[model samples]
Target: MRRYTARLLGFLAVSAIAAFIGAGAYVYYGGYDTSALQQHSEPVYRVLQYVRERSILARSDFDTPDLTSLDWQHAGLMNYETYCRQCHGAPGRAPDSFSLGMKPAPTAIAELARKRSPQELYEVIEQGIKMTGMPAWAYRLNQAEMWQLVALVKQIANMTHADYDNYLVQAQEESPQQTETRPRRSEEIASATELPTMEGLSRIDAGRVAMQQYNCTSCHMIPGVTAARNQVGPPLGGITQRSYIAGLLEYSDNNLIKWIRFPTTVDKDTLMPDLGVSQVHAEAMLAYLKSVE
Candidate 1:
């Protein structure tokens, strides 16, 4: 009986190896088509979509905030226009020609906004689907701003075509070419806390303010913020003590600066988005982070 069991196990192991080798050969030899225009068959597309949706649902544990009543629709509208309108048509617009050619074309987001809850939709925004053109903006935006974007989506989903067009005009008027564009007087765009200069304040104090504004606390356990019990990112209590950043780069000012200013450049698949942080801001934040040790 023991000898029979060993023979069966060896047979299964060999079969597994053979299957792996066959798959590798097929891929390496171009048995799979890699054309963008070659759309996946219905079954393949459905399966991929199911996996993406489930993955988003599994990770979206955040409580949906009070977004319905908030005057965030305007900010959300701008965000939609800037980040999404090109790929997913707005209420009165059509998606661009290039976006329509892609396989599994971007969904009409107004319909999507109506179908999914705010939390579910935010999951898609915060952690973009893999292998899809959709990229995560968590690194670029704060939690408050994200909520406003969501609010705008919900509002647009219910708006008449004329209302949406009117909205675009309004948003355009408010958007100064050089300065930041945000929703009407929401906390997200309220002038940065009237804090002292980075040099006048302790680095920790300055870093804390930057972190708060950037919504770092949403993903990381910042030392002093009350709402920083985050689990998505590594806690930053001993960030400076570590010898590496993201376990890939050597720990140094230049590396840290790059990581902060352009996290996606450091790692292509990183969830961190570019915030367009200035060199001076990153340097100051690094000083505070290093001091936290």
Candidate 2:
């Protein structure tokens, strides 16, 4: 019986190793459709769903603060309108046209809120789910602002279409010109505890601010910046140590500066866009990137 059991275990281990190697080879050979246009197969979706739920549930053990204030809800409304409404539509609204094309399309905020606790909502907001289009807002929003979003999500669960529309109108009236725009500096929306301006900061510090201002965190995993861990582009860490910039220009401060300021000029096919970095800002950013080692 002992020898029979040992043989069975050996067979099982070999089978598992073969399965893993086969899966890897399948992926390596491009047998899997990696397009965002294709939704996950049911088995894959179920596994991902299980992982997502378990991960959120395990990490979302913190206590949610008092979210009962009208002021807080209004703040939440503003944040929702600015950041979330386009993807996760409200009761009376449909998500923007582009969002519909996303595989595992953005879920209804109202329905999601009903299914999830405030703690879970806060966790998901602060730490975005992987393999999902959701981006972490921790770099852009303070703890209070994130909580405000949780409050808004909770309220969204209970609101009617007319109620949400009225809330938007009231929120707009309350803060007539306070909506945040993409091109605006991040400090404008930052909490009072944060530096109001980059004026007095060192060049390196200011460069870090400039990175956030230009929304570089949306793509690259930048050092010295929270929630800047997106893998859409190569990480900026140890960039100074690299032998080349974009594998075209030899590594040098001037070359890097040129790359930052006018990426398209150097390599037109690069996914990097010309963000129109000024000379001073480019130098400052180079200083910060140099310090990342």
Candidate 3:
């Protein structure tokens, strides 16, 4: 028995050494493909797939909201055309050529939405994901605009090509020029200035005021929140209509509460600030936001 134990230990040690040496060789000799154009190996693909699935499962917890009566359909459509269509594609459109080269390429939201809850969808749009190409829009967008985008994503699964095109036209009409567009910095700064003084305002009005007070429009593209000239963040015409918040967090009242009161508490490294919002203000903000649809 003693001899057998010794032999087993020796074998384990040898295996460990051999595995490390092989991995070291692979790294040093550049054995793994580095080209972005190349498709991922089966193992790599499986790992990434698992990561995405697990991420969604763990982060998305809110109940799905009813999108039938949500009135931001046009806003959602416009935002999608300006911000999302290039990577996710529309009913008859293909993703841009550059998007194809991305590892774990951006999935068609139209297809992915079928498997997700609205809250989860909202999280992805608002917070985005780390180590992926997705960027956080919390600093850029206010709560209302975020929700509008959420509403639009909910309808992507059933959108027809003609419907998408019409939306594109509407978005163009909402904001005619592309290159010079972005939210204005001055508006955001002004919004922040008056945020402390506003009282008893509805969430929508509060959000609009907050956005303008903080100059949120300067960095983000919210249709009614700011002018058509500024679009640092993706367009947010119909965010309230979206199902997800940050492409991860489900759009729930509680989650939105947490997000507004303590953004970094949920994700420590998030770029969004706490913004010094009081609980009263947070509650009012959420109440106004929930009224979007």
Q: Which candidate should be chosen as best, given lDDT against the real structure? A: 2
- Cα-based lDDT for every prediction: 0.72, 0.80, 0.65
TM-score list, all predictions: 0.62, 0.67, 0.58
Q: Candidate order by lDDT, highest to lowest?
A: 2, 1, 3
Error of 2 at 135 (Å): 1.1
Give me the overall lDDT of model 2.
Answer: 0.80
Candidate 3: list runs displaced more than 4 Å: 63-71, 174-293
State how far residue 234 of model 1 sits from its true place (Å).
Answer: 27
Query: Residue 82 of candidate 2: its Cα lDDT?
Result: 81
**Clash pairs detected, candidate 2:** none
Model 2 — TM-score against the truth? 0.67
Candidates 1 and 2 compared by TM-score, better number:
2
Instruction: TM-score winner between 2 and 3, please give it.
Output: 2
Q: Which stretches of candidate 2 lie over 4 Å from their true place?
A: 1-6, 70-73, 179-184, 189-292
